[model samples]
Target: MYGPLPARDPVFSRPLQPRVHPAGAGGRLRQFRHDAFDRGMSPLLVVDHVQSAGPEMEPLPHAGLSVATLLFEHAQGEIESVDSAGARHCIRPGDLHWTLAGRGVVRQARARGESLSLDALQILVNSPSDLKQQPPASFHLAAAKVPLIALPGSRLRLLAGQLGAVRSPLVLPQPLLILDGRVDAGATVALPLPAGWNAWVYALSGELALEADGAGTRALPATTAVTAGAHLADVQLRIRGVGTRSHLVVVAGAAINEPLVQHGPFVMNTRQEVMRVVQDYEAGRLGRL
Candidate 1:
């Protein structure tokens, strides 16, 4: 077991950087990625916040990367998603959509006419050498199916990985834990981190104080993310809601130290491999919707 480190100051405290991109017809995407803090947390590449919606969202294809998209906010409506594996699924708000782009696959996700808001977090976890050649796959976990733990003035939603004896049905090749926590003012919660995993906490709303391993607690404001160093292990976090109701997302994963190269949507170990992925996508290898 790893021992906790002293409470330290926040590695960073700032707002999310804004980005504009096109999605489908009549629909644009407002996305944010915390790239300046990308450390060698192997298997994990980028974390993105996306809000995309309109009257309708057309099908868009992506390739060469696996993604776990967690939808936290959305209007009452349905989402139609299809893959080259002939798999089709309908998703609702407060659901999670996971796609392993292995070698490659074509994917299309669109709002079912009734939805006008689609807000989500798209997590990019890099596939290692052995798993990168596998066929593409996807999984969905509806909102109703997600487990929620209630405490005094607080609630926790276990999104992925394990929380005590409760494990998420969505399995990944790599070990990761994703949880959403909410606490009313003055409420405190403690969550233990598994040994040998690097952790991160992103405050979504309100304000909170996070203390780990007896270290000094630090303030976390909205849109702010703190990355606990890869070397820090066996630490348990004590979180307190300071102002109003605080909401946060917790992500933990084993430290990955592999060489990484990324180009657009392709994540590989070398630039040559990224070029190959580009050629394959242009050649229609990933397939069409």
Candidate 2:
């Protein structure tokens, strides 16, 4: 007989918070919800758009924020970006772009194709005070280079951080894990979550069920997100497909108990720091793009 299995905790499900639609040069972007620093997830601030696209954009300056972009769909166009650190790159479809607005930086993205169809996810995270002033860093993860795990009726992709025994190449300012998976109907998957880490599950398409041990099951629909935490033990989230097919993205990170203050593209620990960032940006401290 086999040895005893590992202890697993169930992942509770909840409804997505309010949705926000913001328009910019990136077209009209959809934001799922914002997590608070005290009662909810701290480091992960915003998850924007299951699918988003925009026309050519002018250069923009920012500070005190970190961004992660997941591009799952695109056409002939490419995205070119340059930051304050003088790092520049061009990104295509099925790629991930991470920008750390440590002290300050300037960035710009434009659609290159004639009629590009771009779909992506924009993630905003808060950096701790100690690392906020470090030089801005940026990375590009190609779609073909990302690792993939195949199951019986589902496929798992490691976007950031480690999963099981595999690790991702993309590095962030924080210890965060992001997974993208697609499951066929009638399939069930067990997702392991570390104890005490805050977790979020977003349904990209179709419907599914998320359940924990003591918590009841909840439905997950397309373009919706759910948050879960309070795991005293290792939680094994059970996700079952309730429709023809289901697509999901799971994000988890340790909670930061520090103060969080946000203003526009700036996210800092105190209002004083936020004001400093604004002044820095205005004084051209972030440098030209």
Output the number of the lDDT-best candidate: 2
Candidate 2 global lDDT = 0.74
- State how far residue 56 of model 1 sits from its true place (Å): 5.2
Q: What TM-score would every model get versus the actual structure?
A: 0.83, 0.87
Clashing residue pairs for model 1: 6-215, 7-215, 7-216, 42-256
**TM-score quality measure for candidate 1:** 0.83
Q: Where is model 1 more than 4 Å wrong at Cα?
A: 1-34, 38-42, 55-64, 214-216, 230-232
Residue 2, candidate 2: alpha-carbon lDDT: 100
Candidate 2 TM-score over all chains jointly? 0.87
RMSD of each: 5.4, 6.8
Residue-level lDDT of model 2, residues 1-289, one tens digit each, is 9999744324553466436565544455667545431236546788876333466567777677787777764334566766767888777777888898888788876656565666667787777787687889997888888899887788888888887788998887778888888988888877777777887788888888888777768788776677777557877778888877888888888767788788878877889988998898888887886
lDDT of all predictions: 0.69, 0.74
Q: After superposition, how far is residue 123 of candidate 2 from its true place, in Å?
A: 0.6
